[model samples]
Target: MFRFLTAWIRSLSIRRIPMKIIVIGATGRVGSTVVSKLAARPDIEVYAGARHPEKVPAADNVTPFHIDLHDTKDDIKESLPEAGKLIFTAGSGGKDLLQVDLNGAVKIMKAAEEKGILRFVMLSSKGSLTPDLFSGKNPSPLANYLIAKYYADEWLMNNTHLQYTILQPTALVDKPGSGKVSLGNYTTNETSIENVAEVLIGLAEHNSSVGEIIEMSTGNEPIPEAINHLS
Candidate 1:
């Protein structure tokens, strides 16, 4: 098995080895952007993972991978490739957070660990670490969403063996991103889905981003620059 793994890694090498990055939920807004951005890069093989593979975008370096979050563990395992990195962008869109956000994420993490994937970048939302930020008279959905995220984040941090980065972005807007952001604790209205995608891709490539939970908002520095600082 070790020999097969070593040879497989070696076969992917050119002047430098190309890392395979699986972006789960590739049909979503942020996930699609991440796929587009990474698709043109020569150093990475982007597997655009989604339950509906037909909905995922087509690109030169991006391949559609069918991965159903609710599938049995063995089925889900078979759908994923033996890759070195994973970026989880899957969400239940408030429909079934308990199933998708918590259970599905944990299952994927376990699969990634078993496959010997070293890095994991999760596209999480803000307020996961601080639920009080969302508690108010209206009783926001963010409160419940954060509850699921908090436990998932905790499991990844404490239980998983993979190197991880959890990005907590504020309310997601579909506007064009400034490419600038406040990459830590901050107060802001909304962050462009583009910027969040950029940050997720940046952290995946940044070797030093492991174990960091970055809560961000629109700010003054470019995505790469801001991510470098964290590294």
Candidate 2:
């Protein structure tokens, strides 16, 4: 009876542990930050999904998993069964923008839906909803980026039942985060990548940030308060 009771207690404790959150594109600037921040939380575990798993940080709560955007959805899903929340921070790296940013993103969303994981957060750019926002020359890099983002953002909203938050920051800067931001209509032209990472993690766990496409930048309001206003 004592051994049986001890086994039952152990099972209960294991069941109480929170699910892991996977950060896709974990080698990137923003994605690495997400892995680090989420790893610091005692309640959360992080899987750093990167094209080269060796490049990911070595943290006890963070596990490196290899995931190429070109890989099949079944392969990606099989590699990340423990992931309950999926955050997409992958960029085209100046090559295969259509495949990586659009098609791959859509495939990931479908995998999430099939797996019954409802939480997803995408790191997107501002002006993704408007082609006219580009003022530069034809065949612009920025224009191409926006076009890919536009389709992915649209697909997530139109198809998936996932609790999704798409953050469209005007421009990303490498400066330290202020932990304050303005959500809905960009009030500032640039935002720190650190702040964007924080907001992504916040959206993964917080109920207030769900179901919103926030145009974010550094601002007066605190991150939590700004996200709350969105819902």
Highest TM-score scorer = 1
Residue range 37-114, candidate 1, lDDT tens digits: 898897789899898888876777788989988987678888898788899999989889988998899889988888
Give Cα distance to truth, residue 70, candidate 2, Å.
0.5
lDDT (CA) per prediction: 0.87, 0.85
User: TM per model?
Assistant: 0.89, 0.87
Best-fitting candidate, scored by lDDT: 1
User: What is every candidate's alpha-carbon RMSD to the true fold?
Assistant: 5.6, 3.5
Provide the lDDT at 191 for model 1.
95
User: What lDDT tens digits, residue by residue, belong to model 2 across residues 93-151?
Assistant: 65888889998898888887888777999999988877776544654458778888889
Name model 2 segments beyond 4 Å from true. Answer: 1-16, 134-141
Candidate 1 weakest ten by summed lDDT: 132-141
* Candidate 1, position 108, lDDT: 91
